[model samples]
Target: MDPNEHSNRLSTEFISLVEKINTLSNRTRSSEQPFLGALEQWRIESQQTLDSFCNEKRQTFINSRLEELNRLRTNVEELACVQDVTQQNTNSIKTSIDRIEQDINKIQFNFRPLLIDEHLIVRRSQDLLPFPPSNQAIELTDSSYAVLAGNKQHLLVHREPTLCLLDRQLTIIKETSWPLDDISDICWSSVLNRFIVINSQYVFILDERTMVLEQCLTSDTVNWIRGTCSDTKLYLSTEGIGSSIFEYTLMPSIVLLKEWKSPVTCAHNEWIEDLKFHNDFLGLVIGRCKNNAVCFELRSTVTLNCLWSIQLEEVCSMYATRCCPMLNHQWIVVAFRNPRIFHISSGGKLISADKKCRSPSNICQIGSNLLAIWDQKCIYLQNLCCII
Candidate 1:
């Protein structure tokens, strides 16, 4: 049986017993007449038994999950060791492949010859890394993910008040406070040269260099911001009255551009969780559809037109996604609970999936490094270049 399902059953049974005990206590206390000694004694014994059982069950559930987590970690470490050995031997294999390719080229000199590009190939369970310890670790009250802000800087933000910055070594450098109490997400726009903070109700643009709030954009009819991404133009997802993607031009001032509503044809209710612009021609969005999670391909960012949509495999609980355009292959990572990482191709094909960590919430690629956060506490990093 599923561990989570077993845990849920125990929790439900405990809650029901507690409710019954509370009801019995209330009735006994408010009674007009005193209960018999035998009945009172039975009630006390039953309550004690139930409480003991509840405590036992809770501990059993916690222990079971911890064992499972440790097993997963062991497997990841073994895989990493294997990858390290494989990486060392890659140069020799590449040389052999190069010789074969040259021979094939000579044979097919009269006609167009088939060629293999290393970047186009996909590998399974190739990159799952535990994050290296930070030089100076700082914890925040609100659970959040760390984002690389370029220039060897990292950011860890809380929903309210605090936004902490870290240097190259992951040591706390500086922190900035804001009046906005609820920040849904923050994205550093390399194109716009600013950090855009989404607060559900409005959007704040902070100067990237100065880290000061430069401007605030508001919409009278829109709220419930889900996610945001930017190319030359800013793209925002809203789960307000209707789940939709809004496009706006940031230059000069924030001006409404185009809007695309969530597809009602989707088999399940949709909550557009993440919006990402792959380039001017392509964009990607991850969200739910019925019992499955799905990714939609927006062909045109300007018109917000979806060219195709693919349902992700083994995703019972949808979480986060990251697009790697630097690799030129547009490999996207679709992360879900059981904390698996599914690598989807540009054509919406599932290349591979890996159970990387305990609970992966978000993923991002900075240069050659792929970083992910799990269980609201741990961060994992792996270099994609090595796998490629």
Candidate 2:
């Protein structure tokens, strides 16, 4: 063959070798591209798996915490409910205890009896010649027997007659008789140290030391007499077809001071129940008129006003009146014949009534906290708890 043809064949062989290398390089690059794409897909799948695991763990933790919180809230609500029930029970117990205590106190008071102390004493009178009951004439002296006990020991009067002394209980230090006949009333004067005995028309003053008659008083027929040492005045209630109240002064001899006519025109026909003076300006008078109790007030020596003029529900055969000292003014205490104590104010106002008593003469205040009541045979001391 020719040398040119041989050189051309060699070049063709070299060109074939270069083309085979290029084809091999393209095939290797295609295979490497597929592997790289698969590696990137694996990396993305691994990251997605890690993210799903983390999200599931966080959800589980949140669900557990919520369940715990719900459980704690339920426990707190139950505790509050229990506390409310316990409080209600405590209040109920307290109410029950208070009620029981009140009931016990009431029961104890209802069954309790009056208790007597060392301050109480009793003495009996010695037997003497019994005076006629029809001769109601009696007198008391400053040196005579003490009719009232306690603080009233200073109330001994001077010129009272011996016959006018009622329910006497004394040691009988001395005794004397008066010459006056048909004695109507007797009173003792503490300031004058004498006894004043009243007859139908005259009043005789007798000395306690010498038992001698001192002075005599001339006046109209005196029905009742009350002595007041505060104003140095003597009130004499006169009787006629109509009754009248007269005030007198014993200084410089017995002289009439003032007079108050009866408000009721026919007071003499009616029965006089009681008469008392709360003070110098206030006087109380009670009488029975047509089966009714008429209570009236004498404000001054001239002003007479009827306060409460009403009939009692029960027929009162006898009535007693007393004035009780109060913080504001004097309260009137009235004892009916049926043994009922009625409290009335001096202002014509009724306070309380229907306080039952056993006897008219038995109801008396022993001290601040006790009341002495006579029940016909035995004396009952009552505890004045209401005052306490």
Candidate 3:
């Protein structure tokens, strides 16, 4: 009985020791797992602090660089603004200098005055021959020495035609008499080298050098004649019954090439006072109907046609009409018998109207900036500045 009991007790004690060793092993494993977890948490926290410090350093560097760039941009903008202002001031100074120079030049030029003087040296009564004795004394034609006058009063000057030449002082240099009748108007033809005398029905062209008759043309009563050397054409204005007006042209061969009736018609017995050729196409005809200035144009085939006509406001009678070329042919100055001057375009548009002289009989260009206006008693030299 004793042996069996001891063995059983020993086996029980051994079992208890083995169970205690297993429980201690389990406790150690659980305590070690918690310490390892705490160490891992400390490592993660250190890494986060390092990353935060690095990020703050990077932000400071970026802010410093951005401030430097902004300062550089502001400096550049200020420099550009200063440069622009300097350039503008320089340009303003240059313009002012140029204007001052121009003003000085103008002042210097205007400081001096132009002087003109006329001297009369001689006077003689018989030395000056009167205009040819005719019925109306309508027109005059001149050669180098001879002047042929025509009129409509009685045509007596043609039956006993008188020719006269005068010097600059209007002193008679030569005189001649010819036998003819019924002369109406006279014109000098540079192309034919002749003097043409137009009667009521015929045109007589006399050679200027030889003083011999060259050709004769017969038509209605002629009122005016104008010669053009470029086309070798002579324009003639004829008076018809009543207010009818007709025009004709003579060619180089003294043959009538064109004849046409004017579109402008006057009242009963209205007459054209003067006729002038401004150029090849433009013509001026002054008449008494309402005191109007009639303008005509030579169109295709040199047929005389009316473009536009204007009646002056204050003039009741017109005696002469002439065109003064100016401004490189851009403008024309027309002078009427009532001393009214008008600046008109080539197309018959009136630009300005004013009185220029007192009783101006004839108006002609004497120089680049002057006009010579003559009356029955005196001649005036006028400065035409605004018109030019």
Identify the leading candidate in terms of TM-score. Answer: 1
* Model 3 lDDT at residue 34: 47
Q: List the residue pairs that clash in candidate 1.
A: 268-290
Which one is best on lDDT? 1
Selected candidate, larger lDDT, 1 vs 2: 1
Q: What is the C-alpha RMSD of each candidate to the true structure, in Å?
A: 27.2, 49.5, 46.7
Model 3 lDDT tens row, 177-214: 54444444555554555566665566677653344554
CA lDDT of every candidate = 0.56, 0.45, 0.46
- The total of clashing pairs for model 1 equals 1
Writing each residue's lDDT as its tens digit, candidate 2 over 1-388 gives 8999999999999999999999988877783664455546766986898799879977975676566556555655676678456766556555655665565466442334546454433221111112112212123343432121111221111123453211222223343564544444344444455656555566667654555665456664455432222245555555343566666776766777877665542255653333433344544445555554445443443354554443344434443332232212434344545655554454655655654444433233323333333233333333332310
* Tens digit per residue, CA lDDT, model 1, 28-146: 77744233443466569878987998799779756765665566556556766784566546565456556655654664424355454656433323333333343333343454433
CA deviation > 4 Å runs, candidate 1:
1-156, 159-161, 227-229, 240-242, 264-268, 296-298, 314-326, 334-336, 368-375, 386-388
Name every residue pair that clashes in candidate 3.
Answer: 135-153, 135-154, 136-152, 136-153, 137-151, 158-180, 159-180
Those runs of model 2 whose alpha carbons end farther than 4 Å from true positions after fitting are 1-152, 155-200, 204-215, 219-230, 264-272, 296-298, 305-328, 331-336, 353-355, 361-388
